[model samples]
Target chain A: MSTDSVTVHGYSTSGNCHKVRLVLEQVGRPYQWIEVDSPNGATRTAAYLAKNPNGKVPMLERADGAVLTESNAIICWLAEGTPMMPTDAWQRAQALSWLFFEQYSHEPYVAVARFVRGWTPIDSPRRADLPRLIERGEQALAVMERHLGRHKWFTGPGYGVADVALFAYTHCAADGGFDLGKFPAVEGWLARVGRTPHFVPMPLPHDDVRTLLAQH
Target chain B: MSTDSVTVHGYSTSGNCHKVRLVLEQVGRPYQWIEVDSPNGATRTAAYLAKNPNGKVPMLERADGAVLTESNAIICWLAEGTPMMPTDAWQRAQALSWLFFEQYSHEPYVAVARFVRGWTPIDSPRRADLPRLIERGEQALAVMERHLGRHKWFTGPGYGVADVALFAYTHCAADGGFDLGKFPAVEGWLARVGRTPHFVPMPLPHDDVRTLLAQH
Candidate 1:
């Protein structure tokens, strides 16, 4: 545990990958970012697969070569003992509740729906799946809107890993072709998370984010 | 925090609901079980919806009227400060990582696939979506198979909440048409979690699990 170095293997353009980098920045932890080319099949390589058989991005390599995957898990590990994780048992469970919601209720619709809309052009062969994705995506947003209507953050009064996990892909959901204007509460909550110090935009190509951020 | 009375609102047939009961029984926590009939849309009532807007089952009602929903989240909360939660940060995060995987990569496929196959007839309208569900379901199982191939448990060396989260639906996934025999590692794990004290078999209507246990 004496080693001060941390290396993250993921693409900068990935929302899940950005979750780790953003937390590291927030915690003021020093680490190196090794951009894994996910598009080019870098994760599927034998060496990388040995580290994580799932072959997904956002793999964290500790100084001990003890590899960890799953974006929220890595972030929570880094945020432990800090103000990021609430000390109370129930509040921690509340945080985990949101993290679970992010994966179950939110990501399946918001993230996958985004992929359907943004990654594939309207004329692509996959366009047929768009309507169902949009329907479910809207349902996910409605759930978030209802919750954020009363609370400032997902877990408690303060920002925690829940905010970070949900914030990653949600801020960019419109790019996936779902209208953000329909969810006013989610929009407001997104703005609140953005105002936090050390808040980093989801990883995208520099020029694209530069343009997107300019519009904001 | 001194209140000891705990009540769970759920149905016996639901794996999600069963998970909360399983944990409560395992921890030796005294609690009352209140049934919610999803088949009759009982959870959608205004009374139940206030408890959880998602209208899902397995909601925990603390003695103070504070309600907690989501099976995984509730289990973690109930298990907190107990032997189930790992004291170390990394091991805890690993527990959460698997929980996230269960929700994201595992549950969506296995549980939903089960809902489609088990709840609906073979010629049901939902069967149209079966191929996509089966494809993703098999993929998720493959990921778990690979992970279990290396580690004994999902997180710590001992069984923890991660196992509880995955164990509930996975053991019953055969009802959803998944061939459990193909995944030998997961089969071995099923045997392992089954050996734990207070292990309860899946409940059926008036099935008398205790009587069945005595017979076994």
Candidate 2:
């Protein structure tokens, strides 16, 4: 690991965790990855909560003991001064737009859907919201499809944090029971992001995500 | 208007409105500002809604006629390729972390509180939510105070989109009936953002936001 490196606390299969790791790999930064279990209440521990009051990962711990949480924020900080950010103001905003889209329009649906389908059992109470969640998730994907049709990337011409933000779960959306074939543009965009140099594949969670779901 | 520049839709007083304007001024870009009224349903018209299906302002219309909405996203697009984005991967993440913080933690409290207090009439039914809103708003401010206690800027020394994201409502937080004096660090940070060369103030909406809220 590089001396000035940082450590990321996250579960292997988490989309948010994947977002940070992708940046680390792309930037060629030397950082250690420490797996933290979310299902087992790993984030609720006092030590983890101290790092992030919100009790979410992936959290970045700098050498100075300062810890940062929120996957997109960590990527923005890491990609600053790099080519990851657009050169133009409008382009930059576009990048942020997609990120916001991911959080508000996308994550609430896609991320939560994954939790329901992959983290919870079929008969679990959380599964009650699955249908609506999946429908909303498809709407989010529809938004992505419209945008990806024009731009080669989320912000245009290059793979930036926006791509990273959307790429996290989009590739694995099928596992959430999303029929990825319906969103051809999003599928094409996923292929493009996967082709980026130094791109890292999201690791399969220790418990096969499907297996975890079956238990739920 | 600067030749070949961009155009922004929405009134200045809007928190999202300020985000786009802040970056334009910060980056020295020449862009035309077009005022659109959301409260008055100006954004609901065929022409405006055609540009953004979401019917929100703070829309950035590019020279090529592509329109992008969502204030934080717009600002990030602007800040890209500038020093506003951190150089290191970790630093970039920090910036996004704060941006997310602004959206999830700060905006819901500060911005929503403002809507409840400043935009709504004192005796309006919305007032019932104001006390709880203010209570939660203070909690958000406390989080910011704790973070700002150590760092000069939300992401670090150099200001980034995260600052813009948080700054939009923070400066106008008082109008929302928030006690600005409660958080000195946020106050200082606001002053610093205000001092940035060429920084522009958000113009209050033409139709009183209060009247708009009463209608709701």
Q: For each candidate, what's the DockQ?
A: 0.67, 0.45
Residue-by-residue lDDT tens digits, candidate 1, A18-78: 8888888888889999989785689999988888877788999888888888898898888
Compute the DockQ of candidate 2: 0.45
Worst 10 residues of 1 chain B by lDDT: B207-216
Worst 10 residues of 1 chain A by lDDT: A207-216
Cα lDDT tens digits, model 1, B46-120, are 988877887788889888888887888998887776777787877887888788778777777788776776555
CAPRI quality level assigned to candidate 1 from its DockQ score? medium
**Model 2: per-residue Cα lDDT over B1-216, one tens digit each:** 233588999777779788888888888888999988676689879898678765677898988898888877777666666777666665666677778877776777778777766555667797777677778778778778887888888755788777888888888887667888989998999999899777888876545664554352
Using alpha carbons, what is the TM-score of model 2? 0.76
TM-score of each: 0.90, 0.76
Which prediction has the highest TM-score against the true structure?
A: 1
Model 1 has fnat of 0.82
